[model samples]
Target: MLNMKSRYAMRALLYLAGRYGDGPVQIGEIADSQRIPRKFLTVILSELSREGIIGTKRGRAGGYWLEREPSAISYGDIVRITRGSLALVPCAARLAYEPCDNCVPESECHLRLVMLAVRDATADVLDRLTLADPLPGQVELQPERQAAPAQ
Candidate 1:
């Protein structure tokens, strides 16, 4: 399961994406708009800024904005930045890996292979889903109209 930090990061990024190209936005505004607690969001934003995922400004109008174009930023990027890895199991992780306690030899572990597949699929989906993509429920996917059945 995704951690609170990752969830908050996604919410903050979505809020920033909505205001992209509008210049820096205040932390108070993002917290309020996203319904995230201002105090917790402050820490998250600071970490994101440090990660180069976001840029910050100081003063009355100071706040935060994406350091890169929204289209270039992916959910995977934020999740990896906040949570460190996308893999459900350490042995299946790309960046961070540790042999599972039950597995004697990782090279021959069948479960590791399955976990890796799951990890890969998750990475693919998140990497392709950009911050610029419309927020959930903001757009609906509709099926094409079906043709009349032949007599």
Candidate 2:
């Protein structure tokens, strides 16, 4: 599950995506519309801005907007940036792998194998989505959808 900050970030990013090319949006508007706490939103937006996922301006007309096109930003990108990894265990992480404490070696661990599989499947689903993708219930996938290759 995603942390509150990351969840807030996604909502804010989605808001920005919808308002793309409409110019910067005020932070308060995003917080109010998304029901994220105003102070917390400021921190989240600032982090996103620092990470270059969103751009900010300051002035009477200043606000925040996505640095890239909405379709260019995927759910995977957001997850990785905010949450670090899709893995339930640290060892199963692709980008931030580390051995789990008190665990058996990788080659001998059944749990690790299952977790790696779960992580890949999770990445497949999340990576397949972008802010521009139709909402979950809005689009239907054919049965022909492919499983990700083995890890």
Report, for every candidate in turn, its global Cα lDDT versus the true structure.
0.90, 0.89
Clashing pairs in model 1, backbone N/Cα/C closer than 3 A: none
Clashing pairs in 2: none
lDDT tens digits, residues 95-143, model 2? 8999999988889999999999999999998888888877867764447
* Regions of candidate 2 where Cα sits further than 4 Å from its true position: 139-151
Candidate with best lDDT: 1
lDDT of 2 at 1: 74
1-151: candidate 1 lDDT, tens digit per residue: 8999999999999889878899999998888888899999999999999989999999988889998999999999998998999998899889888878866698778888999999999999999999887756787446799999999
lDDT score at residue 125, model 2, on the 0-100 scale: 86
Clashes per candidate (backbone, < 3 Å): 0, 0
